[model samples]
Target: MKTQSRWIGFIAIGMLVLMTVAPAFGAGRPETTATEQVTLRYSWWGGESRHNAFLDVLDMFMEEHPHIRVEAEYGGFSGYRDRLSAQMAANNQPDVFMSGHLPPWDILPWDARKDLSQFDLDLSYYDDTLMATFYAPDGFLIGVPQAGGVGGSYLINATLLDELGLELPSMFWTWDDFAELAQSVYDASGGTVYGALDEAGGVPYANAGPPHFDISYHNTTITNENGLALTADQLRFTYEWWGRLRESGAVSPADITAQADDGANSPIVNRDVAMLPIAMGSFSRFQDNTPDTLVLFPAPAGPNEPFTFGPGMSYQISAHTAHPQEAALLIAFLTNRRETGIRMGTEVGVPASGMYRDLLIEQGLSEAEEAMFELQNWIIANRDVRGDITVHARYNEFRDLVRAEQQAMAFGRQTIDQTVDAVVRHARNLGMNVR
Candidate 1:
């Protein structure tokens, strides 16, 4: 009777073990506890600061929404478009990506891959101008701008300025005032520094940098309804004026048309240049690179009264994104949220949404950035932000040609009229229908 009872117990135990282990071995592994993870891939081009800031923001985004995972890719500013084109050719584009609208290789065809109308997106959180950059002519907000990259005052070595016993205006300075400042600095430096280290080529056709100030100064852009900037004459005036700076010895001798050797090692970094119009985000970089305290302000005096500081660079979405709606939501959250927006730093443009901008001012920004914020607000309120307009298919080529002319003009090698005509001619030759 004892042995029979023991045998019965053993059989019961074995049966329970089989029931627990059998399902895992049979019929596709018992559904293996499904994982609720959604992965997205995002890419952009920027610096170490930008990359790190972006990673942090994305990490924050992920933490809030544990169901989502993001894979990020970035590189230095140079050769950014090449990577995008190569990746797209491999059909291995990230689920979502960031880009500017120009760079023919990216713009002309990249625009086709997206299908925003079909995507479930929300744009109510973003501002209208910020929405316009990516939208199709009919209407499709391609991406949300990370911020507006506006420029104002140069990082003047106040020690350098005040040491010279010169005083700036109480209110924001105009272009004429800026020229005087540059002149004063140059004179005071006794030729140790040039007033403004002309960044004629900095505003890349491939990328939007502060170099746009030249065109913006003249009330023209690379593209307009009238024609290419050079052809438009109004824009050409600035390039010609740039030539005069060289003639008057207010600028540098380096060829503006060539590659800009900008970094901690450049003349601007050495304080050999009196003025440099770097983005507000990287104002710290200028400080880090220079030997003095740096100050920030608005792009000096608009040629036509006060000027609306236009959107600098934006973080846009791919129209072909399989998860367009989700991507848009991510951007909206990043831009509209006060905390997330401030965490973004100056890596992207200044937050377009006023809500985010307030947070930034409340957080990391230095006195320079705050001062700039105030100046920009004043400009936005007083000047027309929409005063400038952009319209062109071959924007990259157009800007490049203008930059090339700036080089020539700054070097005093070309007449203003000749520079303008040359740029216009090249655009026409490239089959650009610049009106």
Candidate 2:
């Protein structure tokens, strides 16, 4: 009887020890309904409409998770950098933040910005192409594409195309094909209208402004620090192709060059043009602005293949966040197309997630959305990326200079070769390579 009592006492002591240790270790027990509430703060820069959409998603996440709480903050583009810098300095950056490639200004590297990498955020979901940029030279997956979104898809006025009996284009189209179709649309609409709108806004806007987020002069090469993985001759051909389009009137200076920064806010909404080149994910905003049904097609490829692409935005967890795991969870949730039905092309861009592209098709997007989804899927799977010029600190300044040279070429002040030479000289003079 005494022995039994001692064993019971020993067991009680063990249980007590475990109970004591459990609280210290956060416990091996399942989280209770009464566990501490986790609140994560997320901030991004976008228009009010974008804020609304993201909030809706956040709400949906909260509903699904039940225990987690989210605080969202968003604002316009102006002063975003200054505000974020302040946040970083204070070690109070949002749990998750919107990241893009407009660098020198951007504090990426996640370590510097306090980003998280060990979320085991399944890389298999994102297409290999989409994952490349998020990883730096050492292969730290600091961020992930919010939607693996594709940009540069031509958003055509479906009603205009219907009126003209021209079908909205297929997912894959080469530049030559684009020119032919634009010419046809031009002939049908006459000199009074044209087939497509350009992202090129007017001068000083045209001469010295930044290109759309996806428009890039070059991308970082993990292979080499100074030189890019792509050829300068290829980049030259890309510029030459743009020049040809500009010169041939397949794409005119008027539509593309109308809004320096407000590229979407211009004539396209007023129905002044038939097609506007924009990011696939941003189509929702453009669609909301106009009465026309907008369909997406891949960016016009070159004579050989479509170029590579980079992210318009990336979802990065702040290193400073108290809830790194929770923050990464939210990012993973947004990026995982299978969960939200967003990557399926309607909510975000086409699938950059290899595991998730089919899920997008499964979500039953509209015909217009479907085609765009397929195009981006192809790009992601195939690695046809235009990449970015984010590596060079002066890429932006150089790009603005290049834009001026291109505008001069378009305005007939400088010939294509002359402009190219000037651009090469300028880039080389800036301690860069210009083949």
Candidate 3:
């Protein structure tokens, strides 16, 4: 009887130990409910409209997943890149951030972002062609496009055009047609309003000019296996065309064009110009800033009808995040959720996912939003005429260089030929294999 009592005592001690140890072990494991909380930092650059829309989305996300909390870091486009760079260098970047399709962001090293494919994202809702652009050369999916919309268009002030007695250019107009219409607008307006802003040294003009136009007119790539594919003469053609416009007062002067920093101060919004080269994603934002009726037109075609399309922005997860799964979940929620689409509309550009886009359409769209949506569908249907150029890793630097030279030419500090020579020389110095 004493032996039986000792065994029972031992069993009680073991049970007590097991109960204590099991709770300790389970303490480190996250609960499947709100009791286990995860916090994430999300960064992006945009105006107040984008920030407000994103805030609404975040509130909705937190409501659905009560356990996850997202902290938003956002601001205007100015200084955003510098801020992100500083964060990255400190190994303290946000868990998820907005990135553009160009420059330093596009060339971020493979390890800079967590491979998004590892996350439980429903990527089938995304367009395959668009998704391909976000993959690293080594085949890791580095980011997911936030908006798969055409990045370039001619945003014309239809009200201004009507007042000036000028009909809109055809959907299939050419560069020559563009030049003539611009001149006509100048003449009709009695030299008061320029036809378009002088985009001579701007990124938009560069995309529409050397890359798309060169392919159409010269049947040459802007960048090739050899790099900097345009010959000196081919590049000269583009510069000279703009130089002529500047001289004829068909476009804004150097000072006026330089003053156009954003939609608020854009020459078009100010009624200083009738048309502007713009990203289709930001069309609604621009429309909101002005009272005039805005319209979208395709970039003037080259003989070959080549154009470029890319994501307006993409959501990237930091490789250094402690909670990558949660970060990815936020991105997935933004991309695939129906309410997100309805709330976001085209504020972040059109939804990249077809599912969300269809939802937005079914819910109805504002006139400006509908125009952007239809234009994206038009570009996709004509994807065969897409540009065959590659945006280089150093594209941002190259673009700035081109812009500076163009500015010098516009201000009459350099002649067209001199401008061309300087660009070619500097491009080679920048390690572009200018042939």
Candidate 4:
């Protein structure tokens, strides 16, 4: 009887074990389980408002996913690029981070960004043109665009213009119209306010030959390529144009332009100028700094095409991230989810998803934000065929070299022809196929 009881007990215990383990193997293999806890580090560079709003979104994300935690690192743009480059070099960058609207020269060669497409993500929400901006040369989805817009436009201090009895330029004004308007404001104000800030550096080829000439400052081989694309004559034309503006005093002098590079001292922000042409991405931030109400105007048309790079900012995953699935989810939440989009409300740029854009419209936008959306739409319908806007591996060399020579011309140290020749030669030396 005791032996029989032992057999019965063994059978019952075996059945219990089977009951416990059967479900785990029901699909023919044991399923991999997620770690009980995970922590992801994220980083970005922006103003205080952007930093705070991003943190709030992260908080909401963590609350929804109780098993995950996100640590944030964020700050101003100054030195942020260098720091990120160093961290990427050390293989110690955050799990995800903000990528520039165009990739920086230092990080271009490292291939440090992850192939986001490898993960499960719903990219269908983005339009093809917007998607093209963040692709690597290898054709990997290296980064996700956060906002879309006509990147280069003039943000005019309309209130100041009105106060000074200056008529605003139309949305379809040309580059010559821009200069004339600047001169008008300068003369009217009796030198109290410069007419405009020479925005050559703000827009890729503003001072260079017009796009109508089939020229650009960088390669437009496709929507996302970046390279030196100007001939020496084109470069000379741009330099001379700006030199004339400086000589006319319609634009701020070189010393003032240098100071205005600091946003606080910007002619528009300081109420020292009637107009400032900037990318739409800067509309909200610049609006915040000035007491006067500013208005967004279309970028003055070039001789060739009215075009600027679309989508002002992008976010990328680190190739070394151990939690790619989680990182991708976070990116989707920040970029595509309706709630996050509404809360973000054009803080970074216009939301890239059409769905998000519609939601923001439904929710209503501040006047400035609405202006940005309008400009984005107008750009989509009219801008030139966007060439590759992502900076190439040697982009820094080209920018720094050209910038130095350009500044020499701006500050009266170099002639337009000399500056143009120097840029072409330097580009050639860097192996840029600049003919």
Q: Which has the greatest lDDT?
A: 3
For model 4, the stretches where C-alpha displacement exceeds 4 angstroms are: 1-33, 101-110, 136-139, 200-227, 385-387, 390-392, 428-431
| Candidate that beats the other on TM-score, 2 or 4, i.e. the better one | 4
Off by over 4 Å in 3: 1-36, 103-106, 201-215, 218-227, 385-389
Higher lDDT: candidate 3 or 4?
3
State the TM-score for model 1.
Answer: 0.73
User: Can you write out model 3's per-residue Cα lDDT over 129-154, one digit (the tens) per residue?
Assistant: 77776776777887888887765478
lDDT of 1 by residue, 146-251 (tens): 6654434455566567766767544566666766777777778786667776655333332322334544465544554444544346545565454455455466
Error of model 4, residue 8, in angstroms: 53
Relative to the unseen true structure, what is the C-alpha lDDT of residue 236 in candidate 2, on a scale of 0 to 100?
Answer: 54
User: lDDT of each model, Cα atoms only?
Assistant: 0.59, 0.59, 0.76, 0.70
The TM-score measured for candidate 3 stands at: 0.84
Q: Best by TM-score, which number?
A: 3
User: Arrange candidates by TM-score, highest first: which order?
Assistant: 3, 4, 1, 2
Better candidate number, 2 or 3, judged by lDDT: 3
